[model samples]
Target: MNRKVGLFFGTFNPIHTGHLIIANHMAEFSDLDEVWLVVTPHNPHKKKSSLLDNNHRLEMVYKACENYHKLKPSNIEFGLSQPNYTVNTLAHLQEKFPTNDFCLIMGEDNLKSFHKWKNHEVILENHEIYVYPRISSGEVKSELTDNPKITKINAPIVEISSTFIRNAIKEGKNIRPLLDREVWKFIDLMNFYKK
Candidate 1:
């Protein structure tokens, strides 16, 4: 039988604790066998300068997810075109791994801002989407699509964020709890996010 995987795509600038929580939760609660952390090369809406190099981000993701059996990091977007879109990546992944069933796992925060993604409907029409809650926000229409493949999961609402971690690091504050030990060590070794 083919494996069912969830593609959790993001810049993952530093791959913090919240991202790990969501990926693990999706694997455990959703109809997915595992979750692949598809680290994006770039996000159009965010400043590229704020991002760690794609390879570094991938390394951070790998370190953070290494102990989690169901979580793995992929650099699929690294060689792709600039300003990569979810729809295109999904299509490429489907074509590349036709036998695997891939799902889109995202936070409710993205759903709220989904309209901004390119070819959002194509993504919704093709794959299952598992959305974790954002803070106390109630049900809101997914800006991506009205397709029925979207499912809301009652996972932990971890308040940690990469932006906060970067800011803390820049200010010389402790970020041990904000990220995994291996990831923290990697960041320190490379001096990542040092403004």
Candidate 2:
């Protein structure tokens, strides 16, 4: 069997401590050989405004993951067309890296709405999903909870969010503890998220 790779998809408007903590936990504690932080160029459900440029967000990710051996930064979805779906990205990744077993890393909240995703069943059939705990309101379906392909990791629940980080920065709050040192430096240098 090939090495297992966990794909962590996010806008990563700015990679913060919470994102790193969960990613590092999965890498160090789980069977995944490495975790790729896939920087999304665009998310359909989210508003376009208030988001940093694609490259800016990606740069922060790169800086954040620079020292992480098992964690990587990926701009894979950047090349794909806009409003791309998870299934399509998975298919593309599998095609490009046939040897690496790519599993998805998601939050507990996403699992609740997994059925609504386009071709959700196909994704489940083809790849494993690793879910981390999150503060959400819904209950997960029994069929999904019973699925052998889905694993709920006992990872730390990161209460912090990128939005909080961005807002804090804009308000001239020191959010150093919530972000990687390099990422903070990059954001500060670029004057990002500051209105």
Candidate 3:
């Protein structure tokens, strides 16, 4: 049987508890062998200036995910071309790991803009998508709701975001609840997101 691996792609400027919670839930409830947090070097849709160095972000993710046996930190996008698109990364991963079946893990908010992504149709055709709910994300439209391959899971919703955490850190506010203990320590040691 082909092992099912969920690709939870994100910038992960700093990995937080919310991320780990969703990943762990996916691993337990979904038909996935493991969930690999694919840390993107650059997200096409997000601002580059707001992001930390890719290596720094990667290290934080590694530190945050150290205790989770099923949650892995993957730097696969670093080797791929700039402005990494989901379709291309999926293709490359399929080629590289032929024995494993790959799935996409995203939030319902992302589903709203899914069509805007490059080659969105091809991505849907090739892989399964597991969408968890986001607090502010309104109802998923018929197009996505009707899709057979899209599996909607009732994963815990945490309102925390990387932007919120970064701003708190920049303002010298406490963000201990938002981040993993080791991740917060790494950020302090490295002086990350400081104004």
TM-score of each model, paired residue for residue: 0.89, 0.96, 0.94
lDDT of each: 0.84, 0.92, 0.90
Stretches of candidate 3 exceeding 4 Å from the true structure: 43-47, 137-139
* Model 3 Cα lDDT, one tens digit per residue, 14-72: 88899999999999998999999999886555677879888999999999889999989
Give me the candidate number with maximum TM-score. 2
TM-score of 1: 0.89
**lDDT of candidate 1 over 1-195, digit per residue (tens):** 878999998878889888998899998888899999998786556776888777888888989998999999999887778666778788888899999989988888788767667877677778888888887564556344455788888998898878988999999999798889999999999988888
Provide the lDDT at 129 for model 1: 86
Tens-digit lDDT track of model 2 for 3-118: 89999999898889999999999999999999999998866567878888888888888888888999999999989987799999999999999999999999999999999999
Query: Model 2 — which ten-residue stretch has the worst lDDT?
Result: 42-51
Candidate 2 — which residues are off by over 4 angstroms? 43-47
Order of models, best lDDT first: 2, 3, 1
What are the root-mean-square deviations of the candidates from the true structure over C-alphas? 2.5, 1.4, 1.8
TM match of model 3 to true structure: 0.94
